[model samples]
Target chain A: MLLYCKDLTKKFGEITAVNRLSFDVKAQEIFGIAGPNGAGKTTLYNLITGVYKGIGEINFDGSEINNLDPHRICHKGIARTFQIPQLATSLSAYHNIKIAAHFGNEKNRVDKKVIDDVIAFNGLRDKQGIVADKLSLIDKKLTMVAAAMATQPKMLMFDEPMAGLSPLEIRHLMDLFKKINEERGLTIVIIEHFMKVLTELADRLMILENGAKLCIGPPLEVTQDKRVIESYLGNCYAESK
Target chain B: MGHGGNLMKIKKDLGVLLAVYGLLALLPIFFHNNMSLMNILIISLIWAVVAGSWDLIMGFAGIFTFGQIAFLVIGGYSSVIFCKLFGISPWFGFLIGGIVAGGAGILVGLPCLKLKGAYVALVTFAVHMILEPFLKSDIGRAIGTGGAQGILTVPPLKIGSYVYNAMEPTPWFYTLLIISFIAFFIIYKVVHSMWGYSFIALRDSELFAQSVGVNAFKYKLIVFGISAALTGMIGGVYANYVGMLSTRILGLDLFLILMVMLVLGGMGRFPGALLGAFITMFISESLRYFDTYRLIIFGLLVMVLVIKMPQGIIGLIFPLGKAGIIERTILHFREKKAKKAEMIT
Candidate 1:
């Protein structure tokens, strides 16, 4: 396993956001996580990335990372994109990418080649000079992805990468993800809502309901499972099929 | 085309910055032996150095410290006490003062590392105010702080035979001008470096910065150390220049003046700190003729400026919203002309 989480749980006052969740992601696999709103998919990502403290054992590339700081976790080679596109708004896209490149390097150096390659790969070459806040939503998302990729992580997580994108934009991102996975052999974890996206892209799928695991299996098997269908993949999804 | 224009704009801005600094460096030549004017200039330069430091931590790094003046106080006392009791040269005292102040900065920054926004500001203000009473105690007096009466007969900078005394403020002015220039330049370099980019990134979004591997507490401490060190050095120089160190410096008035100057000149810009310092000093000195009314008038002025021109004087002059005023102006005209030519074609 490239990444492993065993018995991870997060609680907020009276509510448990993630409860006894355990999963193992093999190397170079595109793992999809799906659930209804408030199912703690993002909370799980937070726990894995050390953004939130949770009762868990998180091992990334054979190292314990549950107690590591977010930056240290990033240095340990895990990078992620936010659902809302957290970017340095006033700075140019190139500068935003450059900051990440300098910081994420184990040698503490900025690699110009990596910055340019990431920008070009993400199709932000033309908008590289534009400030992130000024870029369109698609471009902002691209910039965020480019920034995450600049960290040179062994594993990358996307939090709803298709949330607000157009159909064409979603297709473009899917292609980019496939390209990245195939070309670089980096493990990918995607938290998404679109059933079709998950079925098409992910090698294995994990479904959650109210922060507890509902099912974990092949994408098709998990989607067709009775509990997943009843709670998340509603009758509409089954009828569309 | 846009990339080419941005490169041109950056080059133009650099040239303009050099020109501005060059002009300021020539101030001694014009003022010559006008001791009173030179005294004002010296004090203004000191404030500029200190305020510029504040700008780096508070404005750029988003630390929002209100107790920056405390570093100056610590620095001034360290130098003056060392000069008086230990017979150290004022020149060496300057270096010691910076180190001492930087140490104090680390102490102050540790508690502040976990704080954010107004809480940081309030805590810093508390630290700034807390030191005054401690210094006024009998132990503080015995330690050469001179209690509430302040330290007297602090020796001026002496090299071989020459003493930069108040009788001739020319040497003092030149010394302060150079020191202030160095402080500004160092800060400029820091804000422009990769570290500076991380500062801005953290300022904008701490989560984003952390996710990308920019350690928040680490960078904040570095900025605080640099800022406090610079300000402390200025304080040490100011003590020698005036030949006095006082508890009066711990007052809210001095700290407010620093904030007003920073806000009025625009925070986050080095030139803004420079302009704010020089202009505020000039206005305060000119209004010193009014005696007691001087402070009230200054307060009103700050209020009006804060309300009317929150971007400060730098914002008004450099409406382009970038760093270099002169270069931004040139770029503005060049772009306009380019657009006009395009229309004609």
Candidate 2:
């Protein structure tokens, strides 16, 4: 397993954002998570990336990674992209990626070839010189992906990558995610709202509701699970399936 | 742009800065006899360093610190106290002062690491507010702060038996010019370095920057220390040149004027603070005839300038496009004259 978590829990005062979540992601597998709003999908990503301190043990590759800072976790080869596409907005897209390439890796020196290859791979070479704020939504998301990829992580996480994207744009992003997984041979854990996207791309899927796991299995079986359908998928999705 | 392109740009910027310094170097030749003008030039150089350092921290690093004046006062008082107590050269005292002030900067930066925008400003400003009372307290008096009267007998800087005094302003001017040049050189290098990119990244989004392996607290604290050390070094020089120290330096008047320099020059634009310092100093000196009205007039001028040119003088001069305001104005007149000539033909 590349990442293993047991009883991971986070709370804000009286409200528990993530509760008793235990999961393991094998190397080179695409794991998908689907949930409704405020169901602790993002909160799980935060716990793994060390953005928030929580109860429980998170083991990555053999050693426990609980209580590590975000930068330290990143150096340990875990990289994530945010839902809103956080970037240095005033800087050029190239510079934004350059920052990650320079600082994200354990090596003290930045490899120009790595930055160039990632930009080309992400199809951001044309718009790389433009400031991030000026880029189109899809281009911004691609730049964020390029930055995350530049870190050369062992595992990558995406939080609602398809949000605010057109159907055509979402298709392109789905293809990009496949290319990143198959071509790079890196583990991926994606939290997405689109059931079709998850059913198509994910090797294994998990459904979450009320900050706890509702079901975990193959996408077809999990989608058909009575509890998952009742709590998250709803009768409409089940009937459509 | 690639790393090579960035290096080329940095080289060009350094050359331009060198040219500006070269021009200032020749001024002592023409204005050696004018004591008042020479004094203005010297003081401008000192404040330029302070304002430039402030720009580095606040504008570039995105750390909104209002305790620059506090650092300046600390450096001045510490340098004088060190010299008087240890009977050491003022040169050694300057180094001591910078180290002490840098330590204080790190101390202030620790609590500020967890703070956001306006809260950081408030915490730093609190340091500024607390300093005067601390310096006037019984502990301050025992520590040779001279209590309310302040330090009156500060030693002038000496080099190989040559003394730098106000009576002979040219030597002091050149010395400060060299110091200011070195300080700015450091600022330029920092802005163009990898550390600079990290600071900009952290400033934009702390959480994202951290996820990308940038340590926000470490970078912010480092910048705070570097900026304070540079400002403190200049403050030490100012103390020696003036040959006195007082709490009056902590007054809001000096602080506001320094801020005006930053606003007049585009904050975040390199070398803009240098130009702003010189121009503001010239304007302030020229308005001396107005007495108390000078401040009111200055205030009004700043308001008009801020509204008219929000990016400041550098933005107007070297806009992103090919033509600046001056070039555009010249082109406009040339086109009008050609139109008139065509009609006559």
Candidate 3:
């Protein structure tokens, strides 16, 4: 397993956000997670990336990474994008990528070429000089993803990357994700709501109902699980299909 | 790549700064006989060092500090007390003062930097409040620290056989100018380095910067320590220059004045500290004839400047690709010229 979470649990005051969740992701695998609203999907990503500390052990690539800082976790080869794009909004798109490159590169030297390449890969060549705050929502998301890629992470996590994107934009992102996984050999974990998109991309899928796992299997099998259908998919979703 | 172009721009900016420094170097020669004018310039230069140090930690690193004046007090008393009690040379006092102040900085900064934003400011403020009373206490008086009255006379800076005195203000002026320039230059290099970039990155977004591997606490401690040392070194020099040590050096008024200079010049810009210190000091001195009403006028001026031109004097000259009064005036002239051209057409 490239990443393992063993009985990870998180509670905020009186509420349990993540309840004893255990999972394993193989090297270069595309793992997808789907759940209804307030299902603790984002909270799980927070624990893995070291943004929030949970009760159980989180091992990444053979090392126990539960105690690491966010930057240390990133240096250890896990990078993630926020649910709402977080960037140095006052800086130019090119500069944002440069900062990430400086921090992400294992070596002390910063390769300007890597920065330029990431900008081009994100199709932000024209908007490179513009400040991040002025960029459209789609462009902001693209810049953020490009910055995360600059970190050279072996494992990349996305939190609802398709939330506000149009259908055409979503298709473009799907193609990009495919290229990133197949060509770059990066392990990806995506928390998304659109079931059709997850069925097309993810090899294995998990369904979470509140903070607990409902089912985990191949995408087709998990989607058709009786408990998931009744609790999450609902009678209307079942009847509409 | 546009690397060469960026290099050229840096070289050009360096040349401009060098030209400004060169003009300032020639100032002593022109004011050799004018004691009052030369005195004002020397005081302004001292302030340039202190304000520039403040700008380093607060402006560049985004560490809010109010204990800078405490460093100044530590520097002043350490140097003066050493020279008076131990018969140490004022020259050696400079080094001792800086080291002690820097040590105090580490002592304060290490624990305080763990607290962010207003909390950091409050800790530094506490340092100042504590130092002020300590300097005025019976323990301080027993040691001949002079308390509120301050040290009346101290040895002047001497080179080989010659002592610089009031009669020879020229040497004092040149000495101060050189020291201030060196201090400002060191600050400029730090502000442009990779460490400086990390400081800015953390300032922009702490969480985002941390995710990218910038250690916020370590950088804050480093900035605070270095800035305190610089301010302390200048404080030692100011003490020897005036030939006195006083608690007023750590007073709230001096702190306010230094802050005003930094704000009037522009924050975060290296040259802004120098410009702000000199211009504000010069204006304040020139208005001294106003006596009682001078402070009121100064307050009004600062209020207007803060509201209308928050970026300071440097912002007026170079507005970061934004328009200024000069740019606006030029555009106005161009518009008039275009109207005339339209009539002809």
lDDT of 3 by residue, B290-317 (tens): 9877767777777887798777887787
Error of 2 at A41 (Å): 1.6
Candidate 3 matches the true fold with a TM-score of 0.86
- Give the residue spans of candidate 3 off by over 4 A: A34-37, A105-107, A129-136, A163-169, A193-197, A225-241, B1-16, B80-92, B138-153, B286-307, B321-345
Best by DockQ: 1
Evaluate model 1 with DockQ and give the value. Answer: 0.61
* Candidate 2's DockQ: 0.53
- Worst lDDT run of 10 residues, candidate 1 chain B, spans B1-10
Model 2 ranges off by over 4 Å: B1-12, B289-308, B320-345
Q: What is the C-alpha RMSD of each candidate to the true structure, in Å?
A: 2.9, 2.9, 3.7
Interface Cα RMSD in Å, per prediction: 2.0, 2.5, 3.4
Candidate 1's TM-score: 0.93
Using all chains and alpha carbons, the TM-scores for the candidates as numbered come to: 0.93, 0.93, 0.86
Better of 2 and 3 by lDDT: 2
What digit string (tens of lDDT, one per residue) describes model 1 on residues B63-157? 88987889999999998888777888888899888999999998899999888899999998898888898788998998889888888778768
Give lDDT tens digits, candidate 3, residues A126-239: 887776777888888888788888888889898999989999999988888888899889999999998878989998998987788889989889877889888788777666
